[model samples]
Target: MVAVGEILLNALFQVLFDRLASPDLFSFVRQLGGGVDSELKKWEKKLRMIQAVLRDAEEKQLTDEAVKMWLDDL
Candidate 1:
């Protein structure tokens, strides 16, 4: 009984390790821009837009409450 349990446990670990090391798993992650360079490029455009909005708000001082609220909603 103990030997059978040990065999099952070893088989379970082997299967788990095989799945974790599979290329398909890595390919799926890469498709979602898991790479550092790809992830940064993905957010670059949004970051630029945010920076521009902040600069504009600072320069204009946003005296209008309605406009300020609209920007805040964003």
Candidate 2:
């Protein structure tokens, strides 16, 4: 169950990053010209939040795996 949750979380993070990296979206945003618009600002906030969650998940995964391995070695 825990592993499945981790897999889903990783997949979600990948999809989010891929969407953020889309060239067409970046080009559209660039065309807007100077100063961040509300929509862009909202997206930036959401992206930051997603990034933070991903970072936390990664840290937790590493810690969990280390503990699991240590226990298995016991």
Model 1, global lDDT: 0.54
Clashing pairs in 1: none
Candidate 2 residue-wise lDDT, 1-74, digit = tens: 24555567667767876776678877887788775445666876787786686556556656687644543342
In the predicted model 2, the residue pairs found to clash are none
lDDT of each model, Cα atoms only? 0.54, 0.64
lDDT tens per residue, model 1, 1-74: 12344346446555655654567865776777748446544555555565566546544545766645554544
Q: How far is candidate 1 from the true structure (C-alpha RMSD, Å)?
A: 20.8
Q: After superposing candidate 1, which stretches have Cα over 4 Å from the reference?
A: 33-74
